[model samples]
Structure formats: structure tokens, C-alpha cells
Target: MNDTPGWASPGSAPSDGQQPGTPGASAPDDRPDDAPRPAAPTEQPGTDPQGPGSKWSKEQPPPAQWSAPTGPQDPAQTPPPPPPGPGWGNQPPGGPSGGQGGWGTPGGPGGGYGGTGGPGGGYGGAWGTGWGGPPPAAKPGVIPLRPLGVGEILDGAVSTMRTYWRTVLGISLTVAVLTEIIVILVQGLFLNDYADTSALEDPSATFSELASAMGSALLGSGVVFVISLVGTVIATALLTTVTSRAVLGRPVTTGEAWRDARPQVLKLFGLIILLMLIAVGVTLVGILPGLLIALAGGSTAGAALAVLGGLSAAIVALWLMIRFSLASPALMLEKQGIRKALARSAKLVRGSWWRVFGIQLLAAIIANIVAAIVVIPFTFLAAALSGDGVGSFLDGTGDFGWTFLIISGIGSVIGSMITLPITAGVTVLLYIDQRIRREALDLELSRAAGVQHPAPGTTPGS
Candidate 1:
């Protein structure tokens, strides 16, 4: 193992007669090519708790040990034809859209985990593409240095789960309860009001009366919703920020959290509103085109609408993600304004959008799965017991509607609450990492944590 830091010239004869770029290639890239290998993924700066910098293992493994390029890589090198069979993005490459990832799959030109002897081959990371999605996350336990996607989000979630499952569960339970309470209360108070009012009950009110009533109702609901939304966002962001601070081995005082988070409140909310606006605009545009086409007599209006909606949603989702991935960290740690934070996020996530996207997607899926397992059965049972429950309650039927509703509510609340803290904590942490990756945010975080970086030549393993 010839140990070297940073990118090396292509033709150096590594111990196994190998070249520098293809660490795990088993063979070297021809000297004529003379390109350099990408730096071994770093352990991230400011990661060492008690040291000056991260504890990076300088030992360079064989090219084979590193990921091989799975599909035709090399922007200059075109891919051979597809291997036949249902190959959409699966096509070899060289086309406009055939190749998905920089190479064949998601990550990039490198072999990645899928190619058998990838970085995560034997004792890779903690959750090597298994904790959730198609594969586990590449790096676990350590926070990323850039904006993350759902899968990475899940990996962080799982990592946090391993450490604080009980706390997370409790939080989830709390969130679930709060959510259910809010839902029930709103329905009972407002929805029930409409259900009971004669004017509301009447479907034939004049346009003026209807407009007035609707406007009144909507205004009232909007006020409440705005209040609730602001409160929830502020509360959730603070909770998440503090919990993340704690998770990252930093301060956990409520006062400290409030102090650090208070000013950033409006910034975070602004980001949220920005995202909502973008989502609304994209959805509206996509839906409009489809609707217009449908009105103009398209046979597959439904299909077009669905396609446009899905595509627009996917693009907007990705755009918003790239835009805001690292903003939380900027707000929480750098104390930047929302616009600046968002810009920081975009800057940090310049080249690695998909990876972040995948990680986040993974996180969402995990939380969803956990929530589902706990909520679905109870939901069914609730439906069975109430006037709204599935089966009509006969006089002889067990009077368990209340029980079912309460249980379901509890289950939902528990799941949401617990998941919320964990998710929030991890996501915020990851956001910090993305900034660290880009702007050495870890150094700031470490300073906040009062830790030093390891000096040169001090290997983590050593």
C-alpha cells in the first residue's frame, strides 16, 4: 500500500505495478494517458474530536480495491451499445440520456458500491447502501461535507437511531401525539363548525353569500394556519437545530439554542416559502399545460398531466434541494441570512447534487416505512370503530371507536414525533457537513465543539 495524500500522477508504479488514478484497478492506466487519480475521499476536515484535523488513513489500497468504473466512463470515451433487454438509462453510454450517473449508475464514473469490490466491499462504512435504498450510504457515522439527499438523510437518521433510539422514539411519539391532537382539534373546531353551520351546510347559497362565507372561513383558517405554520416552523427548526447540536456533541442548552436559532428563524422560513413558491409555480405551469392540452382534445390528458406533474415535481424537487441543502447549517452555524444561507448551500452542492438527493430520498423512505408499520394497522382499526370507521357500528358492536381513534392517534403521533427529532437532528447535521465540505464548515463546528484537528502524518488508525 503506497500511502500518498491528494491526487497523484497517473503512471506511478504503485506496489502492485499499478498506476495512481485507479487505486483498485489491479492494473495501471497506461503511462501514455498519464492522468491523475482523484484524491481518496477525505475523512472531512475538523472531524477529529480531540485533534487538529480529521484522522485520515493515508494508506492507498490497490486499484482493484477501489471502485472500478462500472460502465463506460471517461467523458472522452463513449460507451459501447446497450447489453440488450429493458435498457433505458441502462444503455452503455455515448448518448444524450442513455447514461444516468456520470457513468452508468447514480454516483459517478467510479465503480462505486454496485461493482462488487467497491469502497464499501468488505468492511466499508457502517451502512453501506443497505440501511435503506438500493445500497447503503458510503460514509456513515461521520457527517457529510455537503448538501444531502434522502438516502444520505436516512443514513444519518439510522446512525442517530443507533445512538439514540429511545430519545428518537420518545420524540417521535410526542410529535405523533401533537400532530394527531392538532389534526383532531382542527377538525373538531373548524371542520366541525362548517359541518354544523346551516349556511355552510346549504349547497345552494347565493354567489355573494357563498363567497362571503367561504372568504370568512378561508380567512379564519388561513390565519390559524399561518400562525400554526409559523409556530411549527420556528419550533421545529429550533428543536432540530438544538437536537443536531447535541447530536454533533455540541451545546444543548435551550437558552443557547434559542440564542443561536432565534435570529435565523425568519431566514429558514424564507427558504421554506421560497421552496413552496417554486413548487407551486412549477406545479401550476405543468398542470396548466396538461389541462390546456386536455381541453384542446388530447386523448391522453390524464397521462400527460401525470407525466408533466411528475417531471415538473422531480425537477423542482431537485432544484430546491440543490438550492437549500446546506442553508440550515449556514443559518445555524454561520449565522447567515436566509438568502445567503441558500446561496451557500447552492455553492457547496455544486457538483454532487444526485448523491445528496439519493441520501435524502433514502432518509424519507426510512422514516416513511417506520411510520407506516406503526400507523397503518391502527388506522384501519380506527376506521372500523367510528362513524367514519369501515364497518357500520351496530348497537351490539364493540364500542371501541374511541379506543381505536386514540390508539391510532397515539401511534401516529409517536412515530412522527420521534422521527421528527431524529430526522431534524440528522438533516441539520448533514447540512452542516455539506458546508464543511465546501467552506470548511467543520472547522467552525469543531470550534463550536471546542475540538482540534489532527496534525499531518497522524493517521486515525495509528
Candidate 2:
């Protein structure tokens, strides 16, 4: 009786070990119905056991024609024929019944020869793991097309700067030099000698004199702050374009970057102003109650409450700032308006506020540390070359004349050159990474880069 389905019955050669046409061969009814019968031989490797095959006949190939090789064949050479088994009318290479290199031999496909393995053996017998695991994610450019870790994000920024140093450094250096020149000119012409703070140092100074001095100082600082803010906005817009191109493994010139960034520069400026106003307004609201109390003659208690309120407002402002940190990149890269960009950044940063904050803080710390290393030395040197010498400069009483301003401005320019690219690159890369994690933006990036990415629901193997 055959246990396996679709196997031909061994009619000519009975199950009682008698060959066809022999005297001891019994009729089919002589053997019990439940007795085991060997399966019919298959013609091909890896064929389904239940599928149809060529008809079985009493005739069979000779033992030598179907038997396995006697000795272990050289694995490097061509593989030998598959070993013979019961249905092939041969006892295999061992005992007459069955033994090594026979039907149940280990390391062979389905416990026989002709399997995925070494020379003549099956896969599991000789060597270890057949193939390695799945492939790594695609990296068509500076970053891989997947969600990134912190180190990978930072490395991508640095890699972009290094790979396209000509464009990156050229843009950064030009912007930094122009900004420093304007700042130096403004300080030297309007604030250096005209805005006097000497009244702030006088013990007998009248209230009006102190107020006038303070107002002048604030006006000068406001002018410088506005100039610096404009410079920062321009640099950010340009560098955002550079970094986005670098991620596609494309090189960009200053002209190309300018053309791309020019359209959205105004929107980016508006976004920055709106964010600043929100922060300032929140801070003012926090202290408003205390100011009202102080006007009603509760000065001591009002001061205490104001300090507490200010600290809490600062924390809230910081949270809002981090939450919206991605707006500039969104605005520049997506050509979004101020409100839309702010909403987009808020959406991307919603669940990852702390993570975004940590990365931004880390980048800021690293950029500042590097800038300090480059700037502090120039500051000392500038003091040494100034008119009052290092002592007066260190004491903060020296006149910041052209010599001091020029020397120190050179240092500031150099510092900005290094830090600007880093900060801009990190911001852009963080935006890309967030999109990759949230929206599977890597597929679009891969297509944009001309890399062949698998379709959705498919893998590299498929």
C-alpha cells in the first residue's frame, strides 16, 4: 500500500522482496493492505512530490548507471550524479537495504543527493549559512534613504560640507564677509563714538541722563541686531538650497542657489519675524500681571511673582521655538508661505519635540564650541593691537576703534563661515529625516536622485 499520494503501485516487484517473474513473487493480494510501499522515482530535482510523472515499468536502469560515486569526489570539480535509492531498483552506495549515501542520507535534498549544498552534498551538511541577511538601505547621496540616527544626521551634514566645499564655503565666506563689513561700518560710523554710555557709570548721574544713555545704547544695538538678522536670513536661504541639492548628489553654484532661494526669501523673513513676535509677546504677557501689581503698591511681592512668571514664560517660549525650528527649511525647500510653513513644521515636530530639541541643542553646542575656539584667539590678539593695549580692552573700558573692530570682525567672519553651513545643513537634513520617518519621503528622494527604488510593498529581493 502506498502512503504518499500519486505514487505508482509496485505491481511487478512485490513488497515481499521478490523481483518480477520470480518463483517466490506473491500476488498483490498476498501482502497485507497496510504494508509500506516505496514511492516512485522522480525525474527532476525540486519537483513536487504529489505531481504526475512518467509511467512506471518493470524495466529499470542498471545499478552502475544510477549509483552514486564510490569515493568522495573533488568538491571543486563538477558535481557527480545523484545517488541511487529504493525506487531506482538499486541499494545506493552502502548496504543492500540502505546506508550512507542512500535514500535517507543527511545533507541531501529531502535526505538524498541533489540539494543546495557543497560539491555533492546538501546545503545543511557542509558549509554554514547559505546567504547573508537583507541588504542595507540605499545611500544615493550624502545620507541614506531612511530614517536617520543622530550620528548619521550629523555625519550627513559634515559630509555635505566636505563633498561640496567649493560651493558651501564660497557662499558662506561671501555672506559672512559682507555681513561683517556692514556691521563694522555701522558700529564705527554711528554707534562707536556717538552712543555714549559714560553716564551709566557716573554715581551722581541724573535720572534723565541715565534714561538718555540707555535709549541711545538700545538704539545702537537695535540697528546692529537688524543688520545681523538680515544677514542671517539671507545666509540661511542660500545654504538651504545648497544642502538640499547636496542630498541629491548634485553640485550647486552660487548663482543656482541664489535663483532657487530668491523666491522664498521674503516668506522666510516673515516667518522669522512672526516667531520672534510670538516669543516676545508671550514673555510680556507673563510679566504683565506682576507689573500691574507693582503699580498698585505691592513692589516686593510683585517683583518675586514677576521673576517666577518670567522663568515659566521662558520655558514655554523655548518649547515653542523648538517646536517651530523646522519652519525655515520647510519654507525654503517647499516654497511655502509663512503660516503654511509654520503649520508644516509644527506637524513634523509634534510627537518628536524633545528629540528635535536635543539634536538642535547638540548642533548648537558643537557649532558654538568650534566658533569659540576660532574667535577667542582673535579677540586676544585684537586687544593686544588696540590703542589702550590688552589691559584696557580686557577691562571693557577701551575705545573700540577701527583697528580693534577690523581685527575682531575678521575673526567673527571666519567663525560665521564655519558655523553657518553647519547650522543650515543640520536644519535641512533634520527636515528630510523627519519626512522620511513620517511620510516615506525616501522613495521620492530616490526617484529624484535617479536611483531605482522598489515600489511600495516590495523589497530588494522581490
Give the poorly placed runs of model 1, Cα more than 4 Å off.
1-178, 185-236, 296-310, 387-407, 456-462
RMSD of 1: 26.1
Please report, as a residue range, the 10-residue window in candidate 1 with the lowest summed lDDT: 94-103
Candidate with the greatest lDDT versus the true structure: 2
Winning model by TM-score: 2
Model 1: per-residue Cα lDDT over 1-462, one tens digit each: 654433433343454444555534334345333234544333443355234453334555655444334734666676555453431223222222122222222232334333322222322222223222222212323343233544445566566545655544444444455656776665545654563223554678754465456656765665445444443444456666555654454434555656767787777778778755666577666666665665576737654684677587768766775557666666666677777877877876778687566655666677678879887877777757555445533323333335555766766765666456555655565565565456655445545555554332221210
Candidate 2 runs further than 4 Å off: 1-128, 189-230, 295-297, 454-462
- What's every prediction's RMSD, in angstroms? 26.1, 12.5
lDDT of each: 0.53, 0.75
- Return the TM-score for each candidate structure: 0.50, 0.66
